[model samples]
Target: MKPPSSQGLRLTCLLLALASLCLPIPLWKDRDSLMQEEKAQETGGNLVLSRQEQQLNTKLVSLKKMEIATAMTTGQFPPSMHFFRAKRLIDQSKVFNIIKLMPKGAVLHLHDYAMLSVGWLVYNATYLPDCYICFTHTGTVRFRFSKPHPPHPVPAQCSQWVLLESYRKQLHNVSEFDRSLVRNLTLVTDAPEQAYPSQTFIWKRFEEVFLIASGLICYAPVFKAYFYQGLLEFYEDNVQYVEIRAILPTVYELDGTQHNKSWSVAIYQEVTRQFVKEHPDFLGAKIIFTAHRMLNVSQIKEAIVTAMALRAQFPDTLAGFDLVGDEDEGHSLWDLKDALTIPYSLGVNLPYFFHAGETGSLLQGLLLVLHGHFHLGAVLTSHPLQQQNFSAIILHFKVKQCLSQPQVLTADTHQSN
Candidate 1:
């Protein structure tokens, strides 16, 4: 499949913000209105530079000064504005376009299910052989595959399945149906503020979309295509390598044959191998195997053991383990510490790469960082990821966050910065 457009790549900023642009201190916008320092602080101002890098730095510094002056004159606050609003103007940004051309080393933490465009999933995946679609009673959609004519059981929540290709034929305006399906697969909407009433409501809707997309992506053929598509998108964005936070989803073939998580892990490795072979510049990708955080101690331990076994087989492919879900509602690091210590008791050397502090719990935030010291040391996300939301807006993330407001995080945003 062809890679997504630059506009789709711009959404890549949200993942980077949620994954990396965080610190214990609240992220501050450096607009003249917010701060008035004679000399600005850059992360590596003291570093020695090569001639080429120095030239690039001089040019970038001039551009930065010009942007700050522009914002000061217009008082538009492009870089300091919320990215939800800033994104509408990102295409015209020189800084973002240049960053897109620069090589980014690694994406240490990004959800496997969310790296690509829903438009791709809607138009591409549904056209495959034996694919069927059904609407759940609660109005969510699901996809599955079976022999073209088989007596198969439908999900208990859903109505009977309609072959997607045939269903498209029955539609007078297939484009409208496809658009609706895209909306079902993603939280994108014109009135996201109206769509997401509360944090709990929004999180629930987010999980529902995850479930819907998993049905399509977890099918065997689509799994390979989707993984490769994600890789292609990152490669196009000049990201050299990635570390995907993946669930060991149960993939099923058209013949109703179910494959375990090991099959899924192997496929990830195969896709990465194929991508690196095609694009030798790519340093290759790794999977940080994850499980739901809401699971009990027994279930969490089983997941760790599962990760250990997979890592022994695919040492490079299966990178580590983590528990993924809503941190506020799910069991915290303290609650799951006993289970997290399983790798050590067995001396299995499994590492962790967990995402935390998206919600506003000071205790949870401390536990997540402290959990690293407790065992299986991990890193934190405190670096600036250059994204298209205007250059100044990169520092607009709110780090000392409590439960996030819909407006600040963006109504459709997956998580807080």
Candidate 2:
């Protein structure tokens, strides 16, 4: 009895814990009955519903449940299937029409170049009187607007410049050529995954399409009309407002007159104003000035300065600024910090709407978050993250205030195609 030994004390505590665990606690004898009772109690607290409302809710639930069950059992395709696969079945289903009838909110992330149909671009825009076409050695085509001229020294990469009208006449089937051109200008294919094996490959083709499209739409006459048509298309789809990501390239006239960036921005403003006037139901639109990330530091600074000037000129229409390119191959945001700081130094506020984390890199995403301190408010990304690291970054850094709207994933019908 000279004080209990340590081992004896441990054995005593263990026996006491086991005895407590084995004791019959006053828990519900029938868990199923308890669950039903609690559920009834909870439902009893809810507001009373009419018989018709209850029936409608039940019917909707049953329909959704049946759809899911059928999809699972019969191996039938569901609406939630991959967009490419679902799109194939769209023509046969009412879902496409249902979506078309739905009122879509402001389309905030559309590229100006891709707002219209490629068929319209090739057939309508490129079919203009002065429109010129050049075929590259790499089996791609480029279109532009210029007055008719005799054949001259052509670029080493291009075969020669010819009138699109004449070129169409030479083709055995003009309709087939137009269709093939549309296919080249878009990602529509039988097997998209096979055609575009990797992001790098796909991005290369994407940029190529932009190049081919820019030549057609960047013509002064077509540029103005393009904006109008784009607005009309969006309005017809029940989208009242849109924010277009635009690269304000130098627009050229058929007479070889080059218009500066300001002229292009002015045209956009005028066209948008006129469209809104004509379609009073349409709310409005804004432009997010974008520059290629492949630009040098000087070029980036120039783009920012140009954007600032446009913002000053059209304060209501110029929304923000962004760097657009294949993020995987472009320079990092940190690398261009000095150039990006120009707006701050010049006493102007050009808030950054940067494309970040598209490559799904934690380091790149963190850099973007850190840059948020200097007016980097929103990031455009398509990558889906399941990790908690993104949330952890936001919480740990207290970046909620800096990232005002968080990440925006731009979705367009053509992207799925």
Best by lDDT: 1
Give TM-scores for every candidate, taking all chains together and pairing residue i with residue i: 0.76, 0.73
Clashing pairs in 1: 79-393, 360-402
* Top-TM-score candidate index: 1
lDDT of 2 by residue, 111-137 (tens): 878898678887789777877778898
TM-score of 1: 0.76
Error of 1 at 221 (Å): 0.9
Worst 10 residues of 2 by lDDT: 401-410
Which residue runs does candidate 1 get wrong by more than 4 Å?
A: 1-42, 48-85, 360-374, 377-417
